[model samples]
Target: MPLDEPAALAEGSSRLPTLEFALTGSTADYLIHASPDLLSKARAFEHWESTRLAHGLLPFARSLQTPPAAHTTLREQDGRDVRGLNFSSQDYLALSSHPAVVAAAQEAMARFGVHSAGSSVLAGNVGDGVALEQALADFLGLPHVLLFPTGWAAGFGVIKGLVRPDDHVVMDVLAHNCLQTGARAATRHVHLHRHLDVDHARRLLTRIRRNDPHNGIMLITEGCFSMDADSPDLAALQALAQEFQALLVVDVAHDLGAMGPNGQGQIGLQGLHGQIDVVIGAFSKSFASNGGFVAGRSRALKEYLRYFAATATFSNALSPLQIAVIHQSLKIVRSVEGEWRREQLMQAVQALRQALTQEGLTVWGQASPIVPVLLGDERRARLAVREMGQRHLLANLVEFPAVPRHRARLRMQVMSSHTAEDAQQAAATVAAALAASAQLMPQAAQTP
Candidate 1:
């Protein structure tokens, strides 16, 4: 999402000398008013601007805006998409356009209405929402569940409700921004274990368990990492939690309906059903609806209901139509457990990874669904993404802070709707982009 993110290495290190490059002037009158450090920074950035101008690397994101004005599809872009495939978007399971899901939502809308006139605290909590929450709790094997308007809000509500400043929160290293935001908003002692490093996590939990066992100590992790698409070892982490006497809260945003024995997620997959203290996920992803939820035991749920600050509480509830669609989707996803949707999805990921790997693009992730092409330099990442569009492939770029600097990548998501041929075609488009980007920016790949 970062635009004009400077990649010094991508920009060519030897291309500019520090002292000379750092000596340019701005409106600040470098003749007498500037500190040496400030003058140097200005010059470096000024040199950066000059290099950008020379390479035509400057970008203006005219595509950004509220909906109505936005371009509807990559398909509509000129000289693009005669038949290139999409490697981006979180339409995992691809239930949005499913006929069954569509029909159920229509029926619910007929029975209930487009909008729930008030908040849940008022009269917005519809009958279908009640039933859906019950259905969710049953699937999760939890005693209670609460729905929220969005995954980010649900996460924020959970942490803000449970984690006091005195609390200690530990999470998997690569948790999404939602978890980090929620944790930081709730407490200060936020400790992150290396991605999937439960043993290292256990070491930190040991002290909290013994000395301040009852103090608020929460362990947060994702059921499936969105970017890398790898799953956490829930059974292992659950064991560590019991040993350390800490509460384990997991976000199944990516795993729900795609993981576990019956698509119930890692908690169910590992037989750690009642052991996990809390489970959270977005209804938006799996159900292809517009909300999120938190599930837990009665005690926790009741406490959360009292303290959780979900934006859904103030906003209109999921339209009865959306609730029905979600319920129907969940049921179908469960019933179709042995079907090719899941297998095909895995196959597609493997195929794309293999295809792109052969083409010399650095792809990361296991086959849980997300694929990130590690284009180490930011501008190369940008050029790769732009050329991907030229090849009619729709993918997104990830640059610094969403990832570390120089770890910029194109995060590709796999959807069940994508055919084997679709994935392969997508890979070809990305490969083409890779080759073109390499040729176009030879210096970028040459830097270490």
Candidate 2:
């Protein structure tokens, strides 16, 4: 059945029935259950999802009808093609469609075909994969690197592979889901410090060292958080780790190849290049490929992770084509062209942030590729997202479990290919959408 059309735009109107109903609950409500029957839980969640879908509020799993360029088309749930200014894709440097990157991929496909056919430890370790690993190690200023199928796997594998069950993990509270899951899988003594609070982390490290100095402690943080577009004090974290004799792991997934002077990401920007204990990165963000790597200072650590990391040992390795594309992207990232792209990307980010601010929207974090517009209420955010879609603006709505319950927002990912006009148009559309959403519901009723 087709979703019901959104209520007509009107000034000072009461809340739409659909919008009011969606505000009643969230995904978190269904995360846990007292029912022992697993099927019962699934059915209950399906019912809630169906209601959201029928009301045109289900924004997840949108299909891209075209390439995820600055301007693209998306297929809505009602089978309608909505063309808009796209800020939802993570192609930070816009290298995905670059001529050189595409040519390299074609050449790799011609030579190696499509599949790796086995795990990296087995038959999957192609010549191209090895070269890419070495190139990444050099780029990161680390002596050794190990490849994984994805960025998430890289984050999860490093912790799960090295940290023992008795070890402790100190992580930022706002760290990515992959890192959080990896810490939990590795040990039960996982401690979360306040976001970007170096002192809070020091206290935790102090407490952990006081209790169990013998067991290992792995400190984890990100170069740039995708949601909030913020970073922690890596130098301070490294100092804490050194004082406590712990290992500092920094995931550079969002910022690598997309920020910093030489595209070395936050580590280089913060003057900690080549000094970090572990540096994890993903290619999907800016490398024009889908893969991940863990770079470290010790060759023995690389060899151990290669054999021990289940995500790398049990899973298939990256294909030759992916390795080739990433290698080519890495080359561009190190060249003057990469610097130009980074400059353009930062310019776009600043333009979007300034435009959003000028339009009276609350922008989060500093100058970065991600521009999160704070929408305090989940109900307002959902309605605003629907309005954005109607106005031909494409962005992702993050809510509930991803962030605090009331702190829902629209995450706009900027790319180097986006022009100044694109930023202005996006900000204008966003402002209009928020206004329309507010007008549709002048007063919000209590949701039960």
Candidate 3:
């Protein structure tokens, strides 16, 4: 459906307060209800979403009419096409459209047909799939690797497969949802430490070890946080995990194959490449495919996860086409060409950061593909999202429940293919959109 431009709601309508509730409230507020009926509980939340959708204030579930690239077209809810400089896709190295990657996918399609047709443990382990696993193992310098259908499955699987109910999980407070969910599923002794604070993590580990000395402890963090665009001190985290007799797992979904020298991501950048206990990564970000993998030094652990991880054992294995594309993408990611792409990507990142800073926008995190422009208030963020659509600047709006309340931001994903001009244009468009959004705030408050 086409999204109509947001119009002012009439004063004193019931929907006016609902709209206010929608703008100020968050997803967490509606997650629990006293009502026993499961379906009826979501009515209030659905009403809020519908109100936003009608006014074109909802900036999610957008349809891409074309392939994700440096520039692409998107279909609005109302069926109108909007072309823009794309910064919303996680194609960090911009290998999604590489000629060799596409060729490999096409070749595999002809040879292996379409589907894997079975789980990896059953009959889905095709030649290409086997080769891809080995290739990933080699890339990460880990002898053992297991593949999952998607990154989320891999992340969740690793924790759920290994950690028994008696085990304890100590995770970064800002860790990915899959990791957090996995921790909750595996055990109830979940301790979340401060974001990127190794000392806090160490204290948590010490406390857990003191209370539960016999149970296994798993310390989880990310190589690069997707929302905050930041990373933890891998070396310090590893050392702490070792000191507390715990296992450390680093999720490199956003950084692997896209950053660091030789594409080793934060682990390599921090000189802790092969020393990490467990490394989890996703292929969708930089590998131009849809899959995830867990790499470790222990072959026994890999085999155990293969059979025990519900996602890997139950879900269909990645198709041959995906395996081929990732294989070729891996080759590029490990080559000299990959180094060049990383440099170009960093340059683009710098350019975008500089431009956004020049435009007086508060850009968060370090120099990485994700550049978060802080918008703070949910009301302003909703208005800015609508303005961004009108300005033809494609970026993602992240609000409460994802980040802290009143700290919404536009998470822009930069690619190697994004030029200096693209960065400038994106920054300019964002500045204007935020300005336009700010102008309507007083009016918005009065309407409710």
Candidate 4:
């Protein structure tokens, strides 16, 4: 499977654009890339036999080089129109298509046309974006919020804005990719702590403090990690940040509508609102909208708006319609309808976790809605997904360098829209697929 060293395509050492179509029918696309560094790219091609597999890229959905269709779902290789499943989506409350949200988008189109009409600086600061920001900040127990077009942009901006060249950022080994990419511009005193090992994080902070006492240290993590689906102990993080005098910034992309007392996200639910220095999250997940934001005390947010964020200044602001819909979505996320939906998701997660455990499957997530079914080997993991397609459930396939080399998995996330029935069905199919592939996969067929 080793591909060419990346120079085979389009020359100049950049890996050529290689594509792995859905041999299994999911959006589990694999792109080929030339090495990012030209010298390394040339050396890589020289050393390796420019094959098809060695130059593999990360997962498909993450590239975001292009916008996904409004309601696009991929057809499976099995000829099954399995895209209708309630699993594998970030739409916790299914608010993306809520009548109110759709109507708001329509209204926005009427008022502002399809685009922002103009950039934020030129378009005269739309009221809807402002309103959504305020609403999100209030909900998360922060004083202010600044919207961005993507969560990746927001994550990078948080570190990029706060950390100076000499400052340090110590993060969980498993922190979101956004954090790493952003922190690259600064000193990445990265502590690949044992995932969720709060004690390890504490120890790392203590070491970093002793080593560089005056350097600004920002602790970054996800409120509820998208891949792990496990909630970080915010209480522990709050104490750690305080003890180290490090600013704590949490990205709550996965936890926004699917967590907290009433979907105020983990910050509001944890009651550490004021204690935690910053909160960042996406409007796409849970809220079923598109865009991202950072929240903090009003003063800090004002600073971020004024100078901290580059995306806010240069990128086109989020659509007024996204803002309005997300606002309405958040308002109702924990209301009567949202509560019922949340309960259903909880039941599904519990059922799936139990079923997975009983099948001796190694499900990584603890209680949150995300469940990672580990399967190691990349091509094998992809094949397992092909099997899932046969059963009509789309399981996300993730592979190395995104994760460690042998940590490939089928990352499953739950939606509030899912029913107990959906989880059970997916689990059953997963179990069947595992059994079938047990002989084919030797890395670790059984997990608990």
**Residue pairs with clashing backbones, model 2:** none
lDDT of 4 by residue, 148-206 (tens): 77887788877787788788787777888888878877565555667778898888888
lDDT of 1 by residue, 1-448 (tens): 1112223534445644322122112222223333455555455455555544334332222232211110124332122222345555566677777778889988877877677776766688888888898888888888788887778878877877778898899898898888898899888889889999988898778866666756778889998787776777888887777777677889988878865567776667677776678888897666777788888887556445534565655566666777888898888777864245666666777878888787777888676667888877665666666677666666677665568767777888777666667766777777787677766655424453
Listed in order, each prediction's TM-score against the native is 0.80, 0.94, 0.94, 0.81
Cand. 2 TM to true fold: 0.94
**After TM-score superposition, what is the CA distance of residue 202 in candidate 2 from its true location, in Å?**
0.7
Model 3 over residues 122-195: C-alpha lDDT tens digits?
A: 99978888888898888888989999999999999999999999999999999999999999999988999999
Worst 10-residue stretch by lDDT in candidate 1?
A: 63-72
After superposing candidate 2 on the true structure, give the runs of residues whose Cα lies further than 4 Å from its correct spot.
1-19, 442-448
Alpha-carbon lDDT, every model: 0.69, 0.88, 0.88, 0.67
Candidate 3: residue 211 Cα off by (Å): 1.8
Model 1 spans with C-alpha error above 4 angstroms: 1-72, 75-84, 209-214, 310-315, 442-448
- Model with the higher TM-score, candidate 3 or 4: 3
Task: Return the TM-score for candidate 4, rounded to 2 decimals.
Answer: 0.81
Error at 112, model 4, angstroms: 2.5
lDDT of 2 by residue, 109-221 (tens): 99999899999999999999998888988898998999999999999999999899999999999999889999999999999999999999999999988888799999999
Q: Count the clashes in each prediction.
A: 0, 0, 5, 15
